[model samples]
Target: MTRYDFLPRLVALPGVYRPQADTRLLAAALTQEPLRSGAKVVEIGTGTGALALQAAARGADVTAIDVAWPAVLAARLNGWRHRLPVRVRHGDFEARTQGLRFDLALANPPYVPSPDARLPTRGARRAWDAGTDGRAVLDRICEAAPSLLRPGGVLLMVHSGMCGVEKTLELLGREGMSGQVTERALVPWGPVLRSRRAWLRNQGLAGDSHEQEELVIVRAQKS
Candidate 1:
């Protein structure tokens, strides 16, 4: 079997459906912030628990949630491998978390539109599709985030630039919150390349192999 078929392989899968340069960049951004040792942190869609593990490594108390059972198991194993303390749980981001509030929340939710989507493993449907416009998951998270966060808490999320960044800003504004782009980068959309390339070829841009995906990291704060 290929390495990807191994249980440990899940830990190496991309957190986002596509390659996300900004997601890794957000890790650096988190390092620069005032993340006190043992600060409470909650991560939504904790694929492979990469970000959550990073936070835990910095001595932060972290709870990571994912709808995918295999991903959760993989994350737990990854945490074990690194000797990091991160609680990986199978849960939905839109649901309330047992009255728990956190100092920091992070999510790299699925922001890809349907029709051109790749199915996550059977256990990860909610982790991948964001509905027709690709904002269903994000909308729910934004709506629920204010309640999940403590006063002065922050929520960090990464999404595609094509997923309507301006609209996201507007939604956060309506939620009585504010956000700023902490990082942005161009990365290849390896997940949808087959469909994307087909569409490009149909439009007579076949030779234009410069198709790129944009990654935007936004940090929102509840007033």
Candidate 2:
């Protein structure tokens, strides 16, 4: 069964996308890394607390922040269920984490771009919706990541292949961060791709015959 399937009923509500393979890959990277036990870790978009819980279980001191109330609550509930000591809070990554530096930082922001790109609930919209290019939220995270991370800290993020991996790398480079692709897989894009085809076609692309969306895992370090 999927992690979403195993999640608590309350966490299975709308607007909460479950952790996918990218999440698992990121968790594994953190495990393999040299983060000491009780090292400070921050999770920017703690959807369902899957990654945060995993980090906390590995003995990292974790603080998970999400703008969505339900997501924060769900994360807390999930942490409680798993007996993990994760602090779930309702806040944005850039605004809420001022003066906080962590040994490890991770985020799986809403990298999907859509015209009707509003969250299912008002509370959840802020957690999703990355503006027209789908890079708005991710860009903000990249810009603020350096400040949020301690020296020699790491940042792990996942975004779409359609979101321009090269551009993301450029942004990271500009921020004095270096990253490498850790994992990539083609997965479905749900319903947004149906409407996005016209936009692609306008840019001289064809129909929506592609069934898979690219999932890219990037691990970066602050230099």
Candidate 3:
């Protein structure tokens, strides 16, 4: 068997965010969990349904939501391609899944801090570019996590350290949710960060000499 035989073959459309190091890192952490068959799982920002497929492959009932129409289509196609049953939704997580809770919540949201104050409504950048502080999407996830998860449910979210991991923990903590960093990795700066080097330095999120950033996976559980 080749590597990643477990995951479905994915086809990310043009302008859709493709899986990268961060995606693999989250998937690795996910595999370690004792996921039972038919567990309810919801993946936010399910670009190409990568993580959603991961859960489905393990026999979990999964629902994947994406804000971009192209991503929704890609995810549905990938699910069909592999014969995995994933309910693909077209909308943001909080809005689309309101009043619903899941056994597991997964997110790999836009955490890259962009110079622009407004988030991109259209373009591939929407998949990666958060607002100036990079918390535009991360903050929303932290706030919505408690509501999205059921009692004893777990949230597995990945984001760049530039957005403030402690802040994520703090936001969850305010909601009485307990959280801790389960994984961390330093990855070399990618094209996006390289282009924003000067701005990131200006915002004090990165150093002029820094060449890498930490990607953190936080596992938070509801009581």
Cα-based TM-score, every candidate: 0.82, 0.86, 0.96
Q: What is the Cα-based lDDT of residue 129 in candidate 2?
A: 61
Candidate 3 TM-score to native: 0.96
What is each predicted model's overall lDDT from 0 to 1?
0.73, 0.75, 0.91
Q: Write the per-residue lDDT of candidate 2 for residues 1-223, one digit (tens) a residue.
A: 2333333333534676666655666666655667678999999888888878777877889999987877887888888777789988887677878888999998888876655544434644555566666787888888887899888999988888767788888888899999888888776656556657777555433344766777888888997
Candidate 1: residue 216 Cα off by (Å): 0.5
In candidate 1, what are the lDDT values of residues 82-146, reduced to their tens digit?
Answer: 77889888877656377899999988887766554454456335555665557877888878878
Lowest summed lDDT across 10 adjacent residues in model 2 is found at: 1-10
Instruction: Give the winner by lDDT.
Output: 3
* RMSD (CA, angstroms), candidate 1: 5.6
Cα deviation at 36, candidate 1, in Å, is 0.4
How does candidate 3 score on lDDT? 0.91
lDDT ranking from best candidate downward: 3, 2, 1
Clashing pairs in 3: none
Candidate 2 vs candidate 3, lDDT winner: 3
TM-score of 2: 0.86
* Steric clash pairs (candidate 2): 187-213
